[model samples]
Target: MKRTQNEKILQIQNHTLVVGIDVGKDSHYARAFDNRGIELAKLLRFSNTAQGYEALDEWMRMIMEQKAKTEAIVGFEPTGHYWFTLGDHLQGKGHRLGIVNPFHVKCTRELDDNSPTKNDRKDPKTIAMLVKDGRFRDVYIPADLYSELREAVSERERLQGQLIALSNQIHRWLDIRFPEFITVFKDWGGKTAQATLKNFPTPARVMAAGAAGVLQVWQKHLQRSSLKKAERLVRAAEKSIGRTAGSEAAEAALANLLAQYDMIAGQRQRIEQLMQELLLRVPNAGKLLEIRGIGMVTAAVIISEIGDIRRFQDPRQILKMAGLSLKENSSGKHRGKTTINKRGRRRLREGLFQVMIPMLAINAEFRAMHQKNLTRLVNPLNKMQSVIALCGKLVRVIYAILTKGCLYDAEKMTNDMKRSMKAA
Candidate 1:
């Protein structure tokens, strides 16, 4: 079934059935076309159900029966989570599936029928034609356990982001209610600070409690040095001129926010447990963990996002996926500066960034590289840029470690790096 570049693309035009699916939440719309781009069947829309799946299967079966020699390729947009169910169903039936750019779909809509309009029916055919022209990649669904682990980790990240946002909000509230609170405890969630917030949400409440009473509250709630910090907090609260909000309202909001924070924290813990289990089973994860700054969570994030390292033949592909690759804008007369192309999997890029930070402090190779890049003649990047460049290099290092199944070596790596620089 192999063909030359042009031949492979042209071969799709001979396919018997081209199916376009407009995926949605509760239902999906499908349209079919023949080899000649002639609409064959009426728009077939189905619910997201067992019966709907059955109907979809029957429709494809009928098409196969009619054109025994031609193939069936289904195309759709990667519209968030809406495409997953349909994709799963298509995969289950052993039918070939393809995806089209949502942007491409939108641009082609007006020109497809020259109607200056859009609807579900026309979209399916256009998508099918796009697929027939070999304009899509077959989406990969990792094996079941890997997929579940990936989802769990992704959910944990989302929850963690929300927790951070709430914590920031609480910090802002404290600034208005008790400006000196930050000086007392750096974080609102600290043992001393949370207890203080829960006991005396407002400056007035702390004043009412007095130094001795506030100390007792801290002693009861926190196990720190006999509530010494708590006594200071109370004194600051009494002398502070920070604005006050209503006691009942303030208490309720703080309580509810803390409750949500705690709940999300628990979910994150469970996610970590699941990730630990999954990482132990993934091939060579322990070796990855041996690398400085690569923790269980960060390692899992990289492994899960990157699926099989074999898919990337070289480190550059991995770097590109992490959005660590540079984008150069140059013309015939003018040479433009190079900037990072941040157009890849954001989470993968973020995971690599997190890995780079601790590595900068612990990994000798990374520290050296960070220092080396800072001396560049052109626009030298800041600390963050150096870390990002290290992140790109880290991707290569990880690929080497995973593929070669060897331990990380700083000296050998340094020599190889020197050779590469000389060649460059």
Candidate 2:
């Protein structure tokens, strides 16, 4: 929908220009209005490109000149990547920019026009009205380093998943070729097993090499393992009337799998290096790393997700952003359970979950709280549920540390422990 910047200006108690933009994949439809809600200009469309940016700037300038002395407030929906460029460009131009929620725009659109029909021009106006009412948030644009770190870490996660899948495929190949092999060795990717597999791709090859030849390979490539383990593997290989898969096929599959594994391992190393470098630059990263289980990767994820923690007015906002907010479903007669809202940034939620896992396992206070929350009539959360609840609360702790610039309070957990004890 297009916005009327003039209508926005007319409705404002204070003199301001409201430029509502309906973001699109390749272009943007916009409307401008004055504080009195008067339409000062007709509908305009511009390409979502560099030239389009220039055009938008020229048009904004013309509107400012026509209004003479009023300040300009540009508003647009958070329309995925399409709006990012425009938002960045407008912020660069020194214009005040606010982001309207797309959900709010959809609900408000029908209220403005009950017919449910929509046009690009109409949507922008609705967005501008929402902006004029102060129902918008300023977007956070991370610094270049944080952005690069975010991309790097995200790629690392993707590669890790791929590596796992490849490893699983290798396991499946092993099962088909030698079913009893895994019973003796847990992970085929371990240094000794990888060396064993590289040397003897098939059961027949291992049997041919016997115990002495197998120990030689392990000694050459994986020096840490004792000859005893190699002898055990040789014994397992000799006893097997294992599957008769072709030697050539098994060798080719093993070679391909190892190559992919090596590539992913290299990529992961690079990602870790980048993450550590970027994390060192973030405020209080050293303090965060000092917390057990919160290493450079975890610190990087937390910092990248919560860029410029000062932007949050309070710690609760960070909790809500991470979908850690509590939601109750109580009614007149039915007293329902409370659960997490679970409707915000996924990565933030994941980061908090990851952080809480180690804490729950090792931190004395967290373990006590979890057990204390697992009673019958007074407390109802199961072990798993209690852990999730602790993770949700952990969001508040992390937020407090970031927002208030406080140290990780090993003692602060006492409050939750006391509450659970009282409930029990």
Candidate 3:
């Protein structure tokens, strides 16, 4: 939320105690500093537990009291998953938390003592200085519905990955056991195809069952399947050049893969359902769904990442947070090509691009804007560049919808496109 260096620097005033903590998985080392970056206390080592959190709170309080400070602003690098518990503990104790980038800590460690060597003591001082200089980002932990939504999205992704792996294994089984399986069924995941796979896994079994038996299996689960298709399947199986060895094990492997696929697919559906419910609970999230490209899950994910949109004062901040902000590597004479700086949330950036491609095809306003960007008379952008530009534009629109409670207007977007084109 503290977007400017001045604002961050201002947070560390005369009455503020800056505590730099070197967070670890088991034990953590902390060093306290005053507003002037002067050491306020001896290094304190504490275990990562409830009692340890209490001790940390007491240590900060004792330092604040001893130094005549009123507030404590704790700073630490987000070292993997170790800092989450500590951050939560600090926040609950009514202390402000600042997350310094690990890269910043690594770069700035050598400034003092001119030694690149890093230890617990050296890293704490480096972290504190970075916090004092306002070179840190705010640590945001989504709460309640937003937290639930984020967790659901994460779980869905995990399950989806498993599902993809299962699908690949199933295809691999088919490719080896029955190479001609795809000739009859282009996709083996369809209802009829799945039923056929369930009943007759190999070409030998398919040939044994014949067209009539295959049709019976398909019609058992599904309302109807083509007799002609069944006949084609039998014919393909008869001349199949698939592997004849290990037929039994291969069929069992297919069975296991199919079972795992069904389970993971079901889990993904449940997570999506939970995401939808949570999205509706989040304020102004339904409005996000009104946009053409953002579906229930995508809207939930965007809202989860942005979390309490009022924290951001501008749409550009959202773009930057999503790592869609443009950066260049130019020197005095050498003008370099500009591209997005992927220095922020990776999931948000990936989600935006993933959604944008489908949005270009489905969303009328975005589609038109993309075409205009490509065919513009001056400095026309290519396809990817246009998508990047559109992602930024979309951030502006999303920000407006969340902050101003405005509905997405296709006509207004079209007019804005025309004006932008004219200006270009």
Every candidate's CA RMSD: 3.3, 4.5, 1.4
> Residue 160 of model 2: what lDDT?
85
Q: Which segments of candidate 2 are over 4 A away from where they belong?
A: 1-13, 34-39, 115-119, 226-228, 231-250, 375-380, 403-406, 409-424
Candidate 2's residue-wise lDDT over 1-424, tens digit each? 1134554334455457888999999989999876555667888899988998899888878877877736778889877778878888888888888778788888899876686778898998988878877677666777887787778778888988999999889888887887767866898878877887778867788889877888887778864757677677777877776678576877887899998899999989988898888777777666677565576777788778877776776666776777878899998999898888886678878887887788777777777777776864665788767877777666666667765678887676787577756765
Q: lDDT of model 2 at residue 380?
A: 76
Clashing pairs counted in every model: 0, 26, 0
Model 1: what TM-score? 0.87
Candidate 1: segments with Cα more than 4 A from true spot: 1-16, 34-40, 114-116, 220-223, 226-228, 312-315, 320-331, 376-388, 422-424
* lDDT, candidate 3, 1-424, per-residue tens: 7789998898889999998999999999999998888998899999999999889888888888888999888999889889988988888888888999888998888898888898988899899999999998888888877778888888888888888888888888877888888988889889888888888998899889999998888887998788999999999999999998988888888888888888778888888988888888876768888888788877877888888888888888888888888899999999999999899988888888888988998999999989998998889999989999988888888888888888889999999888877776
lDDT tens readout by residue for model 1, 332-355: 998997778886678888899888
lDDT of each: 0.78, 0.77, 0.87
Error of 2 at 57 (Å): 1.3
The better candidate by TM-score, 1 or 2, is: 1
Residue ranges of candidate 3 with Cα displaced over 4 Å? none
